[model samples]
Target: MQKSVVVLAVLAALAVLSSAARAATDAPAELDLLLRGGTVYTGDSNEPVVGDVGIVGDRIVFAGRKAPAQFSARRTIDATGMVVAPGFIDAHTHANADLHSTDPRKRLNIPFLTQGVTTAVIGNDGFGGFDIAAQTQRLRSAPVGTNVAMYVGFGPVRIDQLGEANRAPTPEQLDAMRQHVSRAMCDGALGLSTGLFYPPQNFSKTEEVIELAKVAARHGGLYDSHIRDESMYNIGLKGSIEEVIRIGHEARLPVHVAHIKALGVDVQGQSGDIIRRIEKERAAGLDITADHYPWTASSTRFSAALVPPWAVDGGREAMLKRFDDAAVQERLRTGMRENLRLRGGPETILFSAGSTKYVGKTLADVAKASSADPVDAAIAVLRDGDLMIASFNQSDEDVRAFMKRPWVMTSSDSSLGHPRAYGTFARKYDQYVVKEHTISLGQFIRSSSSLTADTLGLKQRGHLRPGYYADVVVFDPARYAAKATYTQPALLSEGVVTVLVNGRLAVDAGKPTGVGAGQPLLRTPKAGSCT
Candidate 1:
């Protein structure tokens, strides 16, 4: 009787296991979207494979060599003759201000969308905002149209606490600044960013920055900076790079150099040296990375880039007084001449925006038109208000050299009056990867996507994998190219057929679908665990 009971129990258990297997095989994959017939280039891989991607409710449910037989979706996009890859992420940007516009059309960020970017890291140059919580809340209250990750800017914090004073922060004031960083990190800011090259932040000493960086480090955040000097300015290029490395080492955090460049005649051909130093630091176990735009020209306001920092000290009123004082005029002229020379002369600086008549004219042309010294012409333009200039100061060779480094990623450093704002990524892909062959397509995608995500400590958003957020791009490789030029800065790029952010279509059939599918990405201290 006992033997009979044991045999009966074993038979029952086998029947139950068979039923469970049947249920698993018979169930349908309830996918919301399916992209079929495409060459999938997973950002982490060096090769592409033909496959289908299945998405359901803001997450990828399936991505493999073949589509799951039982999977079906409400919408299916035919991706024939296209390469589907993870969405591009811009490591540095100034589009936060533009996205904050009251107009929804402007907020959609069509320029970025057409270039296949779904995410952008903003608040660069240490001017993101002082109150990061309020800034994020404002962004969340409206439709941002694209994914945004913000940084706590040290510049605004200094301005708020010290009122543009050019002195070392007192201990109490330094603690107050630390509090600001802590608050920002708690409020979901990605990290702390400093524009040590700009006012207020430039006034701060390295010790003060190190302490502030510690606060971000404790929260597992990054230290991103526009270094104090990129050329022949105070501290020099190598000194500035060393300063960043010192901070990262002391603070125990990752350091990201914004728009890494070899600017001016003084720093040309120094890319090899820069790479060696960075590699040495990495070998010593320091986490250092950098981003660069593809353009030889860098855009900035005339006052900030050309005017002597001493002239701008104490604020705009003081600078204006010095600009007008007869005694100081010669001194200013002497300084401006040197500045113009360091920036490759007046011929290299082009007026990109602000004054209609001066637009597209070089500084040399503008100086000649006014019959004034180029310095005087620049001062006149600045006197009207801040004006934009696209300074052609970098070497193409240097740009390519820095780009090939494994630690560097792509960034637009995008703002108004520059073609880079619209065409940076597409231009990199077309001009550098396709035409120049500086890096392979896989390397380009990796640098533009997964590498950025890893540097930023972003979780599950930069790869095309099951269980990851569905931020995807599909483009025709042969057709992908940048249309925007210096003369036509707002023109849209071509070849991106579709872009999905968080499983929602932002760009459909090469055009914006008018959907605001962006969410503010908040970084927590435990974010790395998710990675």
Candidate 2:
């Protein structure tokens, strides 16, 4: 009788197993993850809501209701009473460090993910990012909280080949640069990045830009530029737009205007013209897109501000020597006047980086404290210490108008640019979308997530859809806000409670779980790869 009962139990277990197999064949297993009960903002404009998002392995398995019980995992997160959206993508960043410092506690990163940034495009402003073999190796084994895609920086290539001398490349030199660009792209550069506002790259003629961009095009690369001038003053807004459009037309590649803004007091309201020009370019069939941080202030080194381009003509050491020369100092003043009248006024220059003592103070404030002239204070600061400074120059009206443009994907334009670095996403969602109601939450998420992903051609990310990476964020709209201010710029954003990247728990209950599961945006092998 005992044997008969055991036999019956085995038969029942077999039936249950058969039923489970049937369910697996019919629907996805319950899932390794099941983030349900939240209002899923999928970042898909067409169908935004989903009953649940389920994950199997590293991929999103299901994104609908009534998931099967087959998905059994060791853990699950209940995202109830929150908005589940795609993780934020910072389209522009500068995370170049000469040294990683080799100390975990002394590590300099990990604040990005805390602010809902799952991925960041590092290497901008013609910075030195060409060490792809090294950077790729580093990030491949990195412990950072987010994914990073790098661009082959033009300045790094120029600096490595030719010191920061202002001149166009020779034919052989141009070819060499192309080879470097191609190899970097092969090594995994998503695109070619240029900073027309900086030295070396700024000296490259429009034709030179097109030549490199064509190389980028041959490698399925996009051209992103910090244009010659963003302000509608002297250089004129159309000249810069013309340059990007010219690049697109010549290279037959997509061109992105990095951090589109109208600077300077006189040109503050000319954002509409910039938008019209961009639209015209887009209408003409050249793939033209732009990214802008949801902030008024743009940050850069103070040298770029007070000191003229001529002073920075050679490199760092050259500038220090020039600073000590009285005759050179006089020339520097002439250039500073041009920059002030051209770049923006003193009110726009906010001290974001450098000594903690100078963090919140502006050039005017520094002058007041030092009992010196404002421009002289700027020069002294550069000469004395690191000149990391933020320019609070953009117009709020221009910012709002630019944000409303559908083609304009939002970016931080920041890696360590104070409040914007830590609080751009939250600031937009809270102040603009939630608190102020300038844009809807769905629209905000779309621009922050899906649009950016689509803009970059990074498939399977930037959305909470089935078969996509489970890079997700959960936050309460009412509670969502950025706490980092100009005074306390290091503060993290408030109200985002959960962030997940690649189906793993990266952020649990508003804190990092210390799991870094980021993946590179795979560069597809196409005709472009061959170039």
Candidate 3:
């Protein structure tokens, strides 16, 4: 009896241990989502293959041919016949400026999301806000549909330190500007951006830009510029590119040209010249890259396109006063005539916004109707608030040449007047990749996603790999294309059936899910750097 009792107790203990082991083995891996049977574009690789991607919380937990056997997901998607890729990162945008709109639709950024863009780098062309911390925090205050990153603008910083003054900064003022740049870098600015093509920043000489860029360089940040001129505005096309190269050489930081293009009648076929200079500098081990919109036409304010930089020296109020000054009117007219000629004439400058009567009319048409010179008509239009223009001045050959270059990535340079604001990525894919065959599919994916992320130093959100942020896009290859035009700038794109920002669904089944999962992307300063 004693022997039997001991055997029974041993069996009971064995049973208890077996139950505990089973319980531990059966515990769920708890993945948030799983995407199966999609042709994945890994972004880094040149070819895509069938694969599965798994997400847990805000990170991609698995991305390979085989799914994790242990994990049980709350949501599973059959992405068969779709292209699963990293969501696009727009390298240049003004989206951050519109985040404060009371309209929820604008804040949702559906135009961006539907095109498969997951993030936008704002404050381009030296118009980024002054307080980096405040702007970043404001994004958090009211969540946006797309992730936001910023560059501290030289224009705003210069204007803030010295109010639209048309001269070089004094030593004391230079110190103050440096302090501002440093503060912005500390507050998570990616780098310094200059709109040297615009006022205030236009007043700053190349040496001044180099000095400001050095502050960003110390923090391991980039130097991005709408160069001193894309055409014959001030320094001319080749000279502007040389200035950028000089800045990169002197500052010892990566220099990115915002909206790389050969604009106007004088610079029509100069894309090759620009490319050669960049390639030569790159071979010398200086980092230089550029972003280009797919469109041949460029968009901006009419004042920016037609008005002489000297006339806008003291800001809008001063500009209006100059318009009225009888003494300066003739000079202004002469300057405007020259500027108009550079922009491929008034017929190329189509008004897109600010006046209903002229919305779809070219400056030539408006000028004809008013029975006035196109230059005077342009100046008159500027008097009635800011006018947005679509200047169709570039050559298809120039655009294609630039697009074929590897260093040139895709960007929107998006704003209110242009269809590019709503359709850049989709248009690039549809026209360049699918329709025109200007570049391969893999190259298109890289330019839109990983390359842009790499260029901007967005560390965790570019590739569809394990341990990266789960910002992903799944689109039907056959159905994806841009629908927005200059007139219908708000139309959403098709084909991006689903999008996730930080593992949360922002778009589902080709519709917005009303989840604002985007967060501010701050730069990770390289080791031994100030940021």
Candidate 4:
């Protein structure tokens, strides 16, 4: 009886094992999409791996190595001979103009999508709106083409309480500003962004900035700044760097420098010193990072570039009043003349907006055409209306220096009339990686994608890994190049063959699919902080 029972138990165990084997053989192998045979940069390494990526729903199911034979894909893209990478993330941009536009086509963000930029950080240079919740709601109501992250701008917060006055805030005004920043943090801002280089903000003292930064720190946000000086404007570049570092130390939050550059001739060779200082600070355990645009020319308002901040103290009307005063005229012109010199002369400043006659002309060209002094021509253009200029003041050496740094990621301070808006990523790839060989393709991809995402605290969005969002780009490296020029600033880049945003095809065969698949990426406030 015992022998018979043991034999029966053995038979039952065999039966159970056979059933499990059958179940394994019958398990489904299906995927929503497959990208096959591409040289993939997973954004975590400097080496490219040839592999297939499988996706289902909005997340990657598999990356690297071939998918199993049992898995069948609904659609497979033949990515042979192409480079597959995590979709590029623009660390800084002014694409909010299009993102907020009433027109659906503008909201498509075709320019950015074509360049393989799947995400854009808005509210840069301290011009971001205070009502982040309203902005998020607007994005929900009207979808856009690329994902957007927002910063609570220092400009708006200060201007909300203090008008465009060039004075320090009072104690009560300071408290109000802190409350505004705190509210914005609760509304899902990634950080507090300040354009200390710009007026009104430049007028603010360092202590005031630290106080506001503390509010963001308490709610787990960072501090992103267009530093007080990139050149010898007021505080030298080194001084400005120290200021932001001090803010990070005192406020206890990560700090990011926007459009990092040694602008103008005065600070051209200072990149080495700047890098050392930043590296030292990083070693000391402060979270410090920066972003850079490839172009040598930086864009900004014509007035902001040349006019003395004091002249614009009260606002445009006051600046105009100063312009009309003969007593102030000599002082203003002297300041303007020196400022123009510091920017490498009128020939380097090209007007890109606000006047049809001067839109395509340099300050030198405009002055020559009008038969007036360059400074006078600049003033005349300003009086007509504030114009945007592509100021070609950065040195190639300094640009290359900053580009190679691991801590410095890529960005496009995108604005109208600047080719950077349409072609920053493409241009960087073509000039720095493909042509100059300043950085390897893997380095470029990693910096533009994962490094930026990590610095900004964006989770699970920058790597081509299993369980990550399927925001990916496949491009022909040989053919990828920027077509936009300084004159024709809106031309779309070439060579991005396919783009997937949140697992949906936003671009196919180099054309925008008009798919508004973008979602507003909101940073969740620290636990219990919002309440």
Best candidate per lDDT, number?
A: 4
Candidate 3: give its CA RMSD in angstroms: 7.7
Q: What's the TM-score of every candidate structure? A: 0.94, 0.90, 0.93, 0.95
Clashes of each: 0, 4, 0, 0
The candidate scoring highest on TM-score is 4
Error of 4 at 390 (Å): 0.6
Q: For residues 135-163, could you state the per-residue lDDT of candidate 1 as single tens digits?
A: 77777887867798899999888887888
Please give, for residues 1-531, the per-residue lDDT of candidate 4 as tens digits.
653343344334334545446345644556778999999899989998888988877777667767655567889999889999999999999999899999999998998999899999999889998799999999989989999999999999999888899888889999999888989899999999999989889899999999999999999999999999999878899999999999999999999999999988898899999999999999999999999999999999999999988889978999999999998888899999888988999999998866897899898998998999998888888889998999999999999999999999999999999999999999999999999999999989998999999889888899998767889999999999999999999899999999999989999988899999998888888888879
Q: Which window of ten consecutive residues has the lowest lDDT sum in model 1? A: 6-15
Angstrom error of the Cα, residue 236, model 1: value is 1.1
Against the true structure, candidate 4 reaches a TM-score of 0.95
After superposition, the stretches of candidate 1 with alpha carbons farther than 4 Å from their true spots are 1-24, 526-531
Model 3, 1-531: lDDT tens per residue? 653343344334334545446345544455678888899998879699898888877777667565635456789999999999998999999887566567766777778899999998998999887599998877888878999899999988898878997988899999898988988888889999999988878998888888889999999999999988999988899999999999999999999998889899999999888888899999989999999999988998888888898999999999999999999988999988998999889889988877886898999998999999887788788888778889998999999898888888889998877899888989998998999998988898898898889888998778997668889999999989999887787777898988999888999999999888888998866566652
